[model samples]
Target chain A: MGRAILLDKVNIPGIRAFEVYREHGGYKPAGKALLGMTPAQVQQEVIKSGLRGRGGAGFPTGLKWSFLDRKSDKPRYLVCNADESEPGTFKDRYLMEKLPHLLIEGLILSSYALGVKTCYIYIRGEFKYLVGILETAIHEAKKNNYLGEKILGTDFSLEIYVHPGAGAYICGEETALLESLEGKRGNPRIKPPFPAYKGLYDCPTVVNNVETLATVTSIISMGGDAYSKLGIGKSTGTKLMSACGNINKPGVYEIEMGLPVEDFIYSEEYCGGIKNDRMLKAVIPGGSSVPILPADLILNTAKGQPRLLTYESLAEGEFISGSMLGSGGFIVFDENACIVRNTWNLTRFYRHESCGQCSPCREGTGWMEKILYRIEHGQGRMSDIDLLVRIAKNIEGNTICPLGDAAAWPVASAIRHFRKEFEEHIK
Target chain B: MLKVTIDNILIEVEEGTTILQAARMIGGKVVPPAMCYYTSLKGSGGKCRSCLVKVAKGSAKDPRPIPKLVASCSTPVQDGMVVENTISAEVQEARKGVVEFLLINHPLDCPVCDQAGECDLQDLSYGFGMEETNTREPRREYPVVDIGPLIKLHMNRCIHCYRCVLAAEQLTKKRAHGMLYRGDTIEISTFIRTAIDSDFSGNMIDVCPVGALTDRSFRFKSRVWFLNPMDAHRECSHCSGKVAAWMFGNEIYRITGRKDTFGELEEFICNECRFEKKDISDWVIEGPRKIKRQSVISGNHYEQMKKGSIIHPIEGTTEPQE
Candidate 1:
């Protein structure tokens, strides 16, 4: 409805095929990138595009590319993180399922820009059906000479492989994904040897999210400055939001960044308001890992601003009164939804998915889950609330990976905004 | 060389040294206690969050402090780095929380456990743990099993340090055990509970920080406090044979790797020296091993009562010549 780039040709029948996708102008970006511009020039255009990672972190993709260890003799890599296991997020699956060639085209363009001879799409094991679709797309692209040796008759050569993760949520984490790709137990590595310097097989690697890499094709298709002008401020270009949970129109929607939260929810083009015309209770604007915002905070800032779906606007007040536009897993909750039970449910997922690497995440997550279960089952004390807070605080920053903080943030923010709900359960 | 400050004590250490190593250079109370990190073991630290320290100033170039407390055991030092350990209230509170997490599922059976007096977890809990636990849930329980004929495994007391796993991996030709499952449910296992009959399997007991892995030959022989640990060695073809023979008078109670001030082995002894040869005639005794004065093993167990000293008051104290 609003400047659909990544999902522009998604609805076209047979777009999953390379020929149909080529008819719809797929892989043109790859041709434009490899046949004309140098890798640095491609990187500069990305830098100008001001595109942030569509992954929850929202790091500048261009800047992430700049940090790769190009000076090293070891071969570089581009690992696409398709393990979209974040609780409320499934937009990556939609993109790969409906528009597989778009992702492959984007990967080709991205791989060329980073000088990666080989690329891997590390999709989650659960997405086995989507893996078939992607492999088909890759096969088609290779047949058409869009991928494999000497792409589009250029001196540049490339190969793309599909690697499925063995169904672990932590494998969505870049390092854990790399470890899983290496045929080992998926445990995250300590930093200081970040993926940029030492990653898969001890080479400099760039692991971008599935949606992040897919969006690169659109940026290359439209000139970088033109793409940058579409979205407001730093949240440039369009975002593919997979809206779900009690929304009338629960599906992925591509809206330009800076769209008002209210319009995105209530408009016929998007979520089409809450289901059953129910009262909006809250919204987890990002994936479940980000803070859950109450209805008032999700719709408007503390300063009474009409909140937009940009990274800065959503995080305007920084956890106190705002949240992040993480992965754009827009989940809408009506008044009947119990925050306490939902918090406990999400906590259970984190506790189960914890890689058991570091102490705080390993032990503290299970501890929090037990307390939450007690509180939810009506066997809690008033002290347990504060105890959960204390546990969450300790685990927030003291781990080898972001999973600790992810596990902590939901419980902490749920308690912060919905203490009365927990109290009611205790009562 | 890199200049780093820990708890306001400045020291110069070699480049690539960790904050914990730098703190060890200026020893005493300044060294943050490490439960999982063994200087000899590769890829062993960072799992246990006991040695977390705040980096107040990242380095001379980037003076901005790190937002989160980093594990001092793994984080390498930078030039003109400033670290805060004991001095930071936030660090103290975080450490108290870490101890709480470590103990929430750990069983309280120290009195019956063989590694009681020398357990690192015991010392850590005494220092940083709270007076009373806040957890209301039941602690995780696991049945005691034997990984080998000579090594006892108490999974409940295991803190999942991965030390023994590393020891088995690095010290032996083939590792028999490894960590299985994940989260709090994670356990060190030989999969189908097979016996680890490797000659170097005994080193796992030396590397264990808790009573999880105890020498089966020494179990319940005597409390470590009742016996004296004497530094001794024997000529063996398998290992260095340097060990501490815990003896009661002339009777050998147990034989173990000679531990240092930090409770790490001076040299990993062989199983033959540790479990097989326990007789007094097997090795030449090198007198009493110097135990830390603060340790319960050293309590009232004076190895030196010098002649004419106050300890021997019958000889009388000599007045200073005026």
Candidate 2:
């Protein structure tokens, strides 16, 4: 209804099959990219597309790919990060399960653009069934001369493999994912040698999200300039949002960027409003890591401008009043949902998932979880409130990875926005 | 060469030098205390966030300050870079928090621990920690298990520094113990309680920052303050055999690796030298080892005191000495 780019053909009866997907123009983009354009031309097109990463970070996709060490004689790698383990986010699973060829075609085009000879799709261990579906689609593509050595009568050749993780949430981080893929324990490596410089066996590697690669098919089919015209400003093209929690029609919806938050929540085209006619209390617009915004703040900014789903609009105010479009995980909460209890639950998840490589995250996450548990169980003290803030502040930017900040944000933001509820629990 | 300014003191170092190395060249309070970094061990520094410092300027070319405090042990210095260690209030507060995190699960049993006088955690807590702990949660505990006849494993006292694991891996032909499990519950243990019986495995006791890994022979020996550590060495085919013999009235209490100012071993000694050769007749003594003035072991020794200072009687009172 609202300009569906990815899921428009998602509901087709046999779209999972390679033949059915090809009948709807699945591998046309790969053919177009390989036969009609040079690798540099394809890169230039992606740079002009202005497509930011659909992953939580919202970094520019083309810019991240541009940072690869092209001058290095070592072979470059393109790692497709299918390890989507973030809570409240399942759009990558839906897209991969329903239309595997679309993702393969995108990978083919992306691999060609980067001159990559080999690539890997690092999916989560929990998504075991999706591995079979993706592998079947890849087999079908190779049988048709679309993948493997010398595709479409061109010099570009690529190989894509499916690597499953051992079910650790920290492996979703790019470096940790690479570490897990390399058959090591999944602890995140330190920075200064970012994945772009020396990653995946100490070679230049670029890790992109599943949806970020799948969107490349559409960008290649329609030129980059045309794709740039779709969304507002820098957040161009369509985004896949997996809406859950209290919404009536809760599922993955591919909405064009710049859609008003109110219409997207209330309209029949998207969420179909809250269930049981319950009053909306708060919403974690991104994944569980992003800040929880109250009902009023989720729909409009502090200056009363109508909030949209674009990166700039949602982040109009900093973290004081704003949240990110992180992986497009829209979790809604009704009045019955206790902020203290939910914060405790999310903190427990972070605490359980921390790799314990560094100090701040390894201890701070568990410390916050304990404090939140005490508060939720009605055994909290008045001084425990500020202690949580202090602990979260110390952990926010002091660890080896972003997991520390991720573990710190929910507790800090919930206490900042819902301090009254915490006080009531203590009382 | 690169020019770097740390706490307003300018110094030039080679191109590949780290910020921690630069600060160590300047020495004194400017050097950040490192619990996990060993100059000889590779890939051992960044896991322990104890050496975090603030980068006020990225470099001369890109002057944007690094937003987050970086672990100085791993970050390479850029030309015209500016760093802040002891001078930054932000760094001091963050370091305090790091110390608290490292101690939240630590069992404070310094009174009975064998590594009491020379433990790095003791020095770190004294320098950067608060007077009272804010955590009421119970400290994590693990049953004391002996890894071999010579080494004792106290999992409760480990700060997860991975130093022993690195020492065993780098020093021995095959390592038996490594970090098992993860995330606050992580412990340094062998697979299925295998005996760590390598030629160089005893060096794990020397590299341990806390009282986690200790010599079984030296367990419950005289307190380190009462014994005089003498620089001693012996010829051996296995290793450099240089060590410090803790002497108590002509009897050897224990033999340990001769440590430098920052608590790192000058040369890793063999298990034969450390555990088997304990008699004072086995080695030639050089002299009394010069302990750092701040160490608890330096307080009671006579040579460490001023040359002309008069010895006061322990039991008798001298009230009239002006």
What is candidate 1's lDDT per residue for B1-322, written digit by digit as tens? 8999999888999999999999998999989999999999988799888999999999999999999999999999999999999999999988988898899989979999999998999999999998998988999987666687899999999898889999999999997989888887888899698999888889899999999999888888888887777777888999988888887766787888888888787788778888889788898777677778888876754445222222222343222222
Winning model by DockQ: 1
Candidate 1: chain B TM-score equals: 0.93
* C-alpha DockQ of every model: 0.74, 0.69
Q: Estimate each model's TM-score.
A: 0.97, 0.97
Summarize candidate 1's per-residue lDDT along A242-353 as a digit string, tens digits: 8999999999999999999999999999999999999999999999999999999988899999999999999999988888999999988999999999999999999999
Q: What is candidate 2's lDDT per residue for B141-183, written digit by digit as tens?
A: 8766668889988899989888888888888888688877777
Instruction: Give the C-alpha miss distance for residue A355 in model 2, angstroms.
Output: 0.3
- The superposed Cα distance between candidate 1 and the true structure at residue B193, in angstroms, equals 1.8
Which ten contiguous residues of candidate 2 chain A have the minimum total lDDT?
A1-10
| lDDT of model 1 at position B265 | 79
Question: What share of the reference contacts is kept in model 1?
Answer: 0.75
Q: Model 1: number of clashes?
A: 0
